[model samples]
Target: MKRSKQWDVRGAVGFAAFFHFLYSCATGCLLPFLTLYLRHLGLTAVMTGTIMAVKHLVALAWRPLSCILARRHNKRRTVITGSLVCSAAVALTLLLFPPTGNSTENKSCNISQLNNVPTTLRPRTTLQKFSPSVRYSAEHTINPIQKHNSTEYISAVPVNISTLHNNQSTAETTTSSRSDGKNSSDVQKPSAGKRSRSLMKREQKQEKITKIQYQFLESLKVMDTQQQMFFFIMMIMILWEILAAPLTWAADDGLHEYLDFVDATERHRAVKPWKLLGAAGGIGCSGILVSVLYCLIGTVLHFYAYALLMGLAVPLAALLPLYRHKREHVPGAGVKALQLVRGDSQAMLCAITAVLTGMAGSAVSDFLLWQLQDHNATELQMGIIMAVVPLCQAAFAPLNGCLSRLLKFHGRLLPLAILGLSLQCLSYSFLQTPWTILPSQVLAGISIGALWWSLEAQSADIASPGTELAVKRVFEGLYLDLGAGLGSVAGGFVVQKFGINTLFQGTAAVLGLWCVTLAMLQWRIPRQRRINYSRLLAADASEMSESESEQDNDWLEKAMEEDKGNNNWRRLD
Candidate 1:
């Protein structure tokens, strides 16, 4: 049955924010406690690294299995099941293996370490206190990711500063009570206990990370049929390195800058956890409140709240299209019009589309980034600029879910994407005022949001079929991951050699090419192409009665022989 556009976008914008919130929390949420977790588990650094690396390695395989499961069931069920699995993993991290040791490695003691970081607790400014400086501070660069000059790139979970600080302070008090012992000098501190605890926490956290890696792999596999998975992965590939490197590096520099600036005002900052505890037996809110006062100066820190909110929103928004499609079925003959067609060749076409589209998008984005920053940046500044990619992603990423309803290629959408990229290029090519770059950053955000979702949706349709979804999803992962790994590495090289403008131009050119390829594919396989594709399906329809007989045939045996040669290449297998 020709399904009508069963558009039931139920849920307010707030609902969309909720899911993206969880995902954002998942990113940095674990980090603050990871070392503490490692201490509890008592693992060595080598062991910890192995656990983490192994998780990524395992992720490489698990995605395919999840995709198979999804196909066997369906997209909705697969997502639900995968979500439950993710939740289970999180529970295991927090509750399943509560630190066994009651000594230095215990969870209670780790909480003590946190309590000592006074700056985090009792933040001086009111939550939601947005001042005018947040709008026009020199410290604030032009938001390269927001679609508008005013929309800053503040994506990430809202760090509950008070929650974070209080937790740490509480842990610090517990640790101090142990270290200080009521008599003040009653017993020698056991140094070995501290080392063991840190190591243990590190190991366990790493193990948990490894497991999450596998989960990501499987989700990628399971989501293959949906096509949006490719777009998601593409963003990861194109921006992970750019974002991770700069943010991580710039964070170090930015902290140093903050301390220096604070010093001029006779303001004190919180010490690293161990140092603070050594200086003071334990930090309480009363004591921490003083430190929060110092931070009242750098109020820009709180924009992270908005980032957190946006992250939570985007993923939850996705459930709308899926549920709505299920509900608004036309009466009577609608089911017959939605017949599925399946073929190995069509599956292969789907995979190719993901790779080509990803390549085009990734190349353009990275090139533009490099071109914009090449001229007057230190390596540190370059890293800071690179942070722009993820910051933008955090703000604009939610737009993808919003796009599910409009599948048809809109002429305006592509131009918007192009304009965004071109503005970024011009920012590199011309915009000298650092502040002017903010407008360009906003444009960049829009481009990323539009291109990613549109390409993913289109790719999913490359070879639509009702059967063999497992095999289809496997292809989805192969093309997507391969493109991402290649793209990130290449993007790094391009930035190193060609000046940033050349890189931007190259990326823009690739975007243009990507559109052309998609246009050609669309023209060649016009909707009537469905009727042509249906011929194989229609001819094979009678065989549906003897599905077993067809599977037992000669080609199945031939395909099995080829499977041994190259895994990603299903045709050869």
Candidate 2:
């Protein structure tokens, strides 16, 4: 039986690792480039931002409701499979909306022209000046005799120099004879009429050229068709997020449920390493694939790759073990969690920090690609850059244990993490080349990892008995949903109004100031008054175990009274 249980644990772990890998592969293929793809479709910055913002907002609102429905209906596996299939189908539909008009061509032209405007304008003006004479000679110099085929027209031609001189003398004699009478007006009329005709032709040709140039320039702007397409694409994205967002929460719940059933809850931490590895592999590999496809076809194949991976994961999602155990529903769990957070000043600070961190992280993730594209970074470079972040996170994850010990001793991890985030933001503002930004990603990975770790530790510390999960859920909502949603919208507006550089610089300044405030707040607390929840919880657990083994009823009552007194002391502290 022990061997059988061991085998079951191994199988569950292997299945989970593979499934997470496939799911992450699908997500990594599309999400990093989703904004870039929108911009490629000729949507303005503001429009792209709005679409992204709405996507996140819709996901945030729908995730909880979807999870609740799935749980209530006992359809966890069904929801997971259905959402993946639907998401894959909807993502594949993006291929149907090809870029309209010569927008891509015009955008490229605009960029080149903007760069060399001073040098290019001189040649264009010179060509315009010389075009009319060349056009007139080429188009209008046909022989009159050839068209008329008449003896009179043939006789007017000067076949030799002597005939040309004789014709000129005859014209001069006629002009002399008519110089004193109304016949003089007849002689000048033909010359004036010919000049007016030539001028009219040149003007017409110039108008045509000008109209063509105007049309070419206008193509760089978003057209009505593109606007309609944007709206349609935005709707599809929102729908995609609505369907796909719940998968993460549901998968987590399912994994925990399975672990509980197996009596191997300690293996929960063991699963994260696999998740990180899978995510890093997926992101890195997909990026390279995208670059290759782009080089071969001159178009992004993000959605196609996403669809293929998602389809592969759909079956695995169905196969996932999601065991349900009968348990009594706890009422007012949310209210109790809220009260716990409200009573703890440290928890409130941690919650605020989570919001800020989410905002900064979201802003960077959404717009960093925009900045890189502006620098003309290739798909491969972007892929490597993105892949490095998760890789770094995984590499540095072990250091978190050491950092936790140091933080427990020094209590400065959260503030330092905030400072690191500020520096990362500042670094982005000064980015000159895509490659130069690589090192900053290490800082980013570390800062974000530490910040989240500290927040989770703080949450665990502050949570009251029986309300641990609820408190953690509240923090997750703050960090991932509410904070992320607000960040996307705010970042979009900032980028639209002030440009990407300003957005980065301003965020850095704000975060730096916030870091200082947090440091000052931390310094104000007296050391002796601080509670060590980890030690307290450890001691409480040991005491409870000892009490359970005791046979004396009076000793049990005395222990209960002492526990109550300690709880009151904790509240006061």
Candidate 3:
């Protein structure tokens, strides 16, 4: 059922929130566990790093193309289509590479194979002299027989018998001695047998060890093949991200337009666009929660369930078209959109914010799971801890928005969020237990939630009227993606070389510097130039009132024209 165009605003918001939630779910499910998954498939750290880097590189490359397409076509349609495509790619990858067996099962199976190797040895008594023929026969019996015809063996046997007879006289004294000592030899035989049995056990153990190593090598070959397939699947996912990212931002623009429409109509006087944006954070938070739930369930149950649930975003996003609207023709919209999509002070700031956020986020993502696992945290524990971040973000986002409005500090929220991020890094650097680390994620959540809301609002505030906010969003997404991608690449090397602790410390230091830089920059900007929500609300209200009055006049004129036409038609009849 299609709703009226005025109700499209609500639909647009709903679709945007749902899509954002799904995107979060997909990324959260895959990215947090990606390193572990690659390692399981026997990919070296370097290979893993390369794969991660390539994914971002592909996504970064696609941003420009996606941006152009979003600008030239239907943003909402593009978003919906991209969502479906990315979802399919995720599902295909999951199907191609089924979840690996548990570590314990692989270990136990290898051990059992080694344990089945049998002992292969016999006891030997006294150092009694042997004729050459007897020695050769004994040696031949102990060793593996060569494959040959019966005739050849028979001929050799005759020669061996002749030689034995020739040496028979020489062996006579030795034989007599052996017969005389037989009684004593029998007395000591049991002891010799005991020693030989111990030796045989040792040999069996060694043989088992060798077999295990061989099995391990064979397993390595399988792992390599699995890794290659995994790489291919990940590549497809990255390519999909490249196409999907800009489409997502385009949806952001559509929501912006819808908000503007609501304001002009004065349908919901109490609700503001920024508040709605903040509330939308819940959608993304739900995604994070869902991914975390999958992680927990995967640990306890079958992993296939997790893979399926992670991809639920696709079907949820397919409904975006129901909320879509035709592009409203605004004067100079194209040129303004292009300008905002390009470079400007606001864009640069967004890029800086995104890069710094990415760098910090990369370091955290690389190490958090590892740290938890190292501390012997169970999968369920880790999942809960991981979910805390998004949960906090979800809870705090609306609060931050309200705070921004109440305090009239539009730009200050970012600095506070940065500080929260810095605290998270510091806590990770020092915290010993994985459980203790959970509290620190609240800071991260706050940082992330506030940063997102503030950046989006700030970006919109700076753009000119009639400019599609999606263009600015595209640039924002590009820089954010670039920053995060590059951060992950560097983080891999850092974690490999210096250890996880150092990665956290380094991230904290870097974020600290960024916070300082941001503070200084904000200080230099005059108070009058800073964005005030109060002033913005006043401006929007005046503009909307003027537009509404003009619209009312036009409606009255159109009604009069229709009535006049009806009267003329009746008179003619």
What is candidate 3's CA lDDT for residue 135? 36
Note the Cα lDDT for every prediction shown: 0.38, 0.71, 0.57
Question: Alpha carbon lDDT of residue 14, candidate 1?
Answer: 24
Write candidate 2's Cα lDDT for 483-506 as tens digits: 777777788889989999998998
Candidate 3 C-alpha lDDT tens digits along 418-441: 888888888887867777986787
Evaluated against the true structure, the overall lDDT of model 2 is 0.71
| Backbone atom clashes (below 3 Å) for every candidate | 52, 0, 0
Off by over 4 Å in 3: 1-12, 15-23, 67-86, 89-234, 240-247, 250-303, 310-318, 321-350, 406-408, 471-475, 525-573
1-573 in candidate 1: lDDT tens per residue? 897643222232223223323433333223222322332333222333233323323333444444334333435433433443443233232222212111121111243444565654422221232344333223333223222423122222222233344566568767977876776565545765685587567656765665565555444432211132223423332232222222111221223233333332111111122222211211122122222432332211222322343244344434422222223323321122122212333323344544544444444433432333233322223223333444555455445555554534432354456556655654555646444465665567566556554444433444343222223333434434455435535554564566445655676666566556545554565352223454665675455657665665667787877776567576665
**Winner on lDDT (1 vs 2):** 2
**TM-scores, in order shown?**
0.34, 0.70, 0.59
Ranking by lDDT: 2, 3, 1
For this target, which candidate reaches the highest lDDT against the unseen true structure?
2
